[model samples]
Target: MIAGLFETHLKVADLKRSEHFYGEVLGLELAHRDETRPITFYWLGGRGEAMLGLWEEAPENIQRQHFAFRSTVPEVLRAPAWLRERGLTPRNFLNDGTDQPMVFAWTPAIAIYFTDPDGHSLEFIAMLGGGPRPELGVISLEEWQSKL
Candidate 1:
């Protein structure tokens, strides 16, 4: 039986840099480090909920990937400033110079996007309490709330 996403892996140009970003910056708990390989694992939600792996690789061999972390509405609302404080630029889905979270009307979820040091797209997302509103398309938090 399938439960949910257990783990995901990404190739990083520098393992130690990615480790500090995911572990120290994001506060993910360290799961393991393989001395035999240039790889490290960090627990996402907890020790067993989900895991993320970062493998060291040459810049030429690395490919950027996108992933999102589950979060609450309140947290997503505050994420822009928090990210800015850390020198990270929070962006909307369109990334058209807007640094506010946007709601995907189709999924009715709010999300803020950013990138890690290695330029891997990352997001913090939270599902909203409503039926789908695909017709509304993606809109800013203020617009979404005005409709509510």
Candidate 2:
């Protein structure tokens, strides 16, 4: 049985730009940079915890993708402002202008969405300690807490 995700790859429009975003902006640790290939790697949580690979490709060849980083509830609460301070816009799951994390009633997880330079969707998510409430649908953290 699979324990957890170990790695994921994304096609980036520019390797250098993606490197700065992941290494400097997001603060992931640099693992390796291949000189023979237009690719770079970073450690997600800690060294050897998880890995993310960015492969440089032409814009036409790059397909947008989505992925989420495991995060804590407190960090998720602060994500919107943290992202804004870094010159990024934090968005809800629906991305309808609201800049707050939402709780998915089904999984009851909190998550905030954002995009990378190449428009690849990214997320910071944390699971909540509760049973699923699918009927309540996706709602704001405040609304989710009020029902608790």
Candidate 3:
């Protein structure tokens, strides 16, 4: 029987910088790290949930990755400004290179997008009420919530 997800490993150009971003800036707990061998692991929430390991490597060989963390409605709402204060630009999931957090009608989740130091697209999402998937375009969380 399937239990749950364990962790994910990602390659980063600089372990120290990535460590600071994932740890201090993002507020994830550093579960384990080894600067000598140059690999670091962090927990999404304390020692539970799941862990993420950042491995040092050359930038050219490191293909960017994307992932989303589950969050609550209030947290998702406050994320854009909070992330911006830390020097990260939050964008919409459209990858349009613009800062526009959105709400999807299909699965009904509020998602805020941003790129990490490694240029990996990341997202924070909160599940809301649902409906049939729209053909295209996303709406603001305020607009999505107001309709209900």
Candidate 4:
């Protein structure tokens, strides 16, 4: 049976710089690190919901990717400002031409997008309550089939 997800890893360009950015700037705690293996790991949250892992880059190209973290309003507010203070100005917190906080319709979540020092796109999102959840709502079997 599937239990839960423990962690995720990323191949960072510079271990030193990535450590400084994720550990110091992002306020993530350094849990375990091995200079010999040249890999570092950071623990996130009290219950370890997520982990920040860094690995040495190989000769192959490192493809840039994006990831999002679920957070509260306070965290959402702090993220943009924090990025700005560090001179990493985001393209925009909210989508361009919209006052909303870079959100999607029918989902009560706000997302913020920015790139890391190595040009990896990262996002932080906050979920709001009272939004439509398919599992929580009832639907007729015939209606569902018809829509599909």
**Which stretches in model 3 have alpha-carbon errors above 4 Å?**
95-98, 130-137
Of the pair 3 and 4, which is ahead by TM-score?
A: 3
Q: Count the backbone clashes (under 3 Å) in each candidate.
A: 0, 0, 0, 0
Model 3, 79-108: lDDT tens per residue?
889999999898887768766668887777
CA lDDT, candidate 4, residue 80: 67
lDDT of each: 0.92, 0.94, 0.84, 0.66
Q: How does model 2 fare in lDDT?
A: 0.94
Q: In model 2, which residue pairs have backbone atoms overlapping below 3 Å?
A: none
Model 2 Cα lDDT, one tens digit per residue, 1-148: 9999999999999899999999899989999999999999899899989999999999999889999999999999999999999999999998899988999999989999999999999999999988989999999998999998
Predict model 3's lDDT versus the native.
0.84
Q: Where does candidate 2 have its weakest 10-residue lDDT segment?
A: 129-138
**Best-performing candidate as measured by lDDT:** 2
Off by over 4 Å in 1: none
TM-scores of the models, in the given order? Answer: 0.95, 0.97, 0.87, 0.75
The lowest-lDDT stretch of 10 consecutive residues in candidate 1 is 19-28
Off by over 4 Å in 4: 1-4, 93-100, 133-148
**CA lDDT of 113 in candidate 3?**
86
RMSD of every prediction: 1.0, 0.7, 2.2, 7.7
Question: What's model 4's TM-score?
Answer: 0.75
